[model samples]
Target: MTWRASVLTIFPEMFPGPLGMSLAGKALAEDKWALEIIDIRDFALDKHRSVDDTPAGGGAGMVMRADIAAAAIDATKARTPAGTPLLYLSPRGTPLTQGRVREIAQGPGAILLCGRFEGIDERVLEARDIEDISIGDYVLSGGELGAMVLIDAAIRLLPGVAGNEGSLAEESFAEGLLEYPHYTRPREWEELAIPDVLLSGDHKKIAEWRRAEAEKLTRKRRPDLWAKYRKS
Candidate 1:
């Protein structure tokens, strides 16, 4: 089945933005995957089409209404494939990982809810049993970008979406490493030369060198990942 991504957001125009220009775009055009854009405002009950309001007990910003969010989610869920996971993009959610992206990509697809302002009401998330996922620790103006980031990541993993399937296996996080540094032509550029092992064309030695470099970089740059890699 074609991998699918449904995004529900207040800003519908933001979607298929960057996702419409790169490898993801190519896959989309080829029907390797599909994108569904749902405007949250379309579910608003108010005459002004407002979807958010002042947080209960007072807060700094408006919170998205639970009713509207539920309405949008339910409508989308009805049309999407059964068992497709529903995800809400939030800073407090579990940090997204390559493993999770792979799992989602292998599934039927996902329904992403892009929260705005302070965020969607907790009740809707609880009632729908939606999973919250964070792209990173930092917060953005809204979840639209997060939704796009997630969709793009998953789409590339769909079969036939990537031009170089072999390269995907060596990409960063493919094996819980940061990935070894890469070098290109102009083998000797300025002062740097392509690693001798790479130029030697010895697959076995090249692989060994790459593993070592990946380990070194991971240990120095992401001790968290390195620690997990070691334990595993």
Candidate 2:
């Protein structure tokens, strides 16, 4: 089945090439999936094509007009089946995880809403079927980057988006731990030799060594993930 994504943003041109450069890009080219960047301005009602309005309480930044954003999301969502959910990228959302991205990848399609200024009006979410997703704890100037990050992570999980099926398991966070060290080319680089285990040619031993290294790296760099890994 083909997986599709619809992105709603004020700046649609910021996408395409960026998303087009990675696995998601290749997926779009190969027809394994489809992605449509819908400009919210297209649904604007005014001559100046204003999609945002001054805050109701006189805030410093303008707020995204609920109706305009809602209309854009609705239009894109109607093109998909009922099970597909619309995702809004927000700083105050559930932190994204590999499992979540995998879940989204299995869907028939999805809609991504990119909020700007002071963010889309809260009423938009109340009126539509949507969930908020945050890539990290940090705030971003806009949701465009978050949407792109989400799409890239989801696309790679699709069949063939990743050229090496084995690679899916080795990448960082694939199984909740960081990836192990990798070595290539000359046995020695600048006098730093490749790991002896990798050169041993014993697949079982190599796998074991890699796992050990991955665990170590996770423990040192991401204790939170390491703690959860141990619990699981």
Candidate 3:
């Protein structure tokens, strides 16, 4: 299924490069999905096209003007389908997960709002059915980075987006564990030899070795995800 996504941000140009440089770039040019970048500044009303204003309670940094942001959202919505779902990127939100990416991929509804400075008004969120998703628990300078992360995750799930079907199935979070180790043409590095099992020419044995390595990697690196594996 083809998914159309729009990003509302003050720095629209910052994206498409960082995100569009590698696999995401190939996916975009190939039209596996559609992407639109809208500059929030374009929707501003002043001569300077200022989109931020002083905070209401006399804070340090300027807060993004609610009305300006709301107007940008409206403009983006105009380009989307009738029921497109909007997602606002913020630190004070639920951390994004793989499940969320798959959910968005299955539906043609996902828009990302990249906020700057202090942030957008909370009223706009309360008034809409928008989803607040954070890339991580840490705070970012702006939502542009977070939006890019979301975009990449969503793109990887699209059918034919990845050249290898097995690649997707073995990616971290595709199962309950991290990806297994990979080997290339070198076969040996710094006197370290490749696993003998991999060169045995037995596909079944190779698959089993990968699964075992993935389980070990998960238990060592992410105990929390491994715990879920145990429960299941």
Alpha-carbon deviation at 48 in model 3, angstroms: 2.2
Which regions of candidate 3 are displaced past 4 Å? none
Q: Looking at candidate 3, what is the lDDT of residue 90?
A: 92
lDDT (Cα) of model 2: 0.89
Q: How much does candidate 3 score in TM-score?
A: 0.93
75: Cα error in model 3, Å: 2.0
How does residue 136 of candidate 2 score in lDDT?
Answer: 91
- Candidates sorted on lDDT, descending: 1, 2, 3
> Lowest lDDT 10-mer window, candidate 2?
17-26
TM-score for each model: 0.98, 0.95, 0.93
Determine the C-alpha RMSD for candidate 2 after optimal superposition of all C-alphas.
1.3
Clash numbers, per candidate? 0, 0, 0
Compared with the true structure, what per-residue lDDT tens digits does model 3 show for residues 15-51? 6866677777888889888888999999899999999
Q: Is candidate 1 or 2 superior in TM-score?
A: 1
Better of 1 and 3 by TM-score: 1
lDDT of 2 by residue, 156-221 (tens): 888888889998888999889999998899998888999888989899999999999999999999
